[model samples]
Target: MSPANPFTRRKDRIDELAATAASPSGGIAEAGAVDEKPGVSLIASAWSRLKRSPVFLLGAGITLVFVVLALVSPLIAPHDPAAGLLLDQVRPQSNPVPGPQDGFPLGADSRGRDLLSRLLVGSQQTLIVGVFATITGLAGGLSLGILAGAFGGWVDALVMRVVDVMLSIPSLLLAFSIAAVAARPSQVTVIIAVAAVQVPVFARLLRGSMLAQRSSDHVVAARALGVTERAIVFRHMLPNSLAPVIVQSTLVLAVSIIDAAALSFLGLGNPNDRQPEWGQMLGRAQTYIYDYPHLAIYPALCIIVVALGFTLMGESLREALDPKSRR
Candidate 1:
């Protein structure tokens, strides 16, 4: 190799010396240290964390599958859920079983309706009940919570007292009571019953979250700046306060599913056999449970899986939101 230029050789030596001099004093380096990054919005950060989590991935997959199933059920399901294609092939199985017939994949229910079709169609019903009920609860809770949080004193006391009264009783019992009093049991009755049980929970959660944020620096700064009360509450407080509510809403969906199913199981849900709902299917299967446990198993499995999916996603979100948990 040609001899290095004198100036270039000197510069390289100097650079090496500088790096050596600047090295950390101790043998141990700050191995775990990371540069502090600019802060991200709560939602963006949560989403980033969620994307990295296996639990979130699994829950999202399951949720997506169910959502897809619900949307295209009519197009994909082989047979009408209300009408069974093969009654002769329908027989009680000690173990969960499918049919020999090409058209009937999951076999028929106690009424000879295709079990697969029912399960597929049933997803739509369960999703509707779980989602709409949560929405109902969220609405009631947001209204009450905002009033209590934004305007304290008697308004807070009054809303909280009512919430406490409802909270004292078991949620399921309260739902049953509501269903009994609200005319006859039907689809509408089931939704309202489930929604009623969830209202207090949402209301209490929002109130506490809002209260904690009420005295926050940002809120105080907004007040000092003479921002309108309406703007402060709606824009600043509500947005920040809603993260917990959104997470709670996911969890509430799981509860709503169970409650709707429980009501149907108790014969307080839609009584029409023509309508294929998981809980109602479970209710019907109760009579033949001993002879054919499969009848109950299929519907119960679907319910459990769906609820588990929502629960995992919600818990992942909760952890994402919590700084302590994130660490």
Candidate 2:
């Protein structure tokens, strides 16, 4: 105590300061902890960015509403979608769209079916066509892309030439021709038709993406290491090349929805008035369009809104994934 050890005192002070700095409120520790946190993956980062984007929000919101509407239609819808006035279930007489007094807020069709109910139930079909068409196209396209991209040489050229030939024709026309020839007009026919339209687009996109990825350092390394070509292409290249294809698939959903609707409107979809398909609804509406424009407007508006939602989502995803497009 006579002369406090200067070094000991200094050491005590340092220890005390270090304890404080290591406490819950230490600024340096907080900063260091943050720095030590794991970095986000490209997909996670893209998702985070997409969540922050108003465009993504809008698109997702619209699509979600339709999805919800479709899923819970039986509960939320005002009336049985198939409930019609005529003996044949065709509302050929109820062209007089009624008020809510009859439980039809959105009005009635020529078959006297609740327009609102039909519209609500129609969401299911619309989504079905869109989803199924997307799946069909993606399956076919992925196969072709992988085959062509992995094989190269004549296989690539052959596949690409076929794709090119298909691409040369208008997508809708090709779909229409296929639908007309292969099957009877219905949801299945329409689905196949729309999927056929999308096949070339997906095939080309995935093929290009795979080709680009093939030249990447990782791919080359795998090749150098004697990895099987199948393993390299399927395991390594395919996964990396999927980003663009995924983005394109989103955009394609919008196109598929629109195309499905077009086919229905053109009489290639379900013709039964009882079947509530947006496109079919539009087709049936043509009969009473002059008397009740709402008939045409409702289905058209639904198609437009749903398609817009997918389009927005696709575009937003594309921009989020592409660093060059980020603001």
In the order shown, the candidates' Cα RMSDs to the true structure are 7.8, 6.5
Query: Against the true structure, what is each candidate's TM-score?
Result: 0.85, 0.85
Query: How many Å off is the CA of 149 in candidate 1?
Result: 0.6
True lDDT of residue 227, candidate 1: 99
lDDT of 2 by residue, 1-327 (tens): 498799999999999889978899887677677545788888899999999999999999998998999888878888888876432444345524553345666766665667788888899888999999999999999999988888889999999999999999998899889888855677888888888888888889889988898889999999999999989988999998899898999899999999999888888887676668898888877867787788899899999999999999999999989998887
Least accurate stretch of 10 residues (summed lDDT) in model 1?
91-100
Cα deviation at 310, candidate 1, in Å, is 0.3
As a whole number from 0 to 100, the lDDT of residue 235 in candidate 1 is 89
Worst 10-residue lDDT window, candidate 2: 86-95
Please tell me which predicted candidate would have the highest lDDT against the true structure.
Answer: 1
Could you tell me the TM-score of candidate 1? 0.85
Residue 217 Cα positional deviation in candidate 2, in Å, after optimal superposition: 1.4
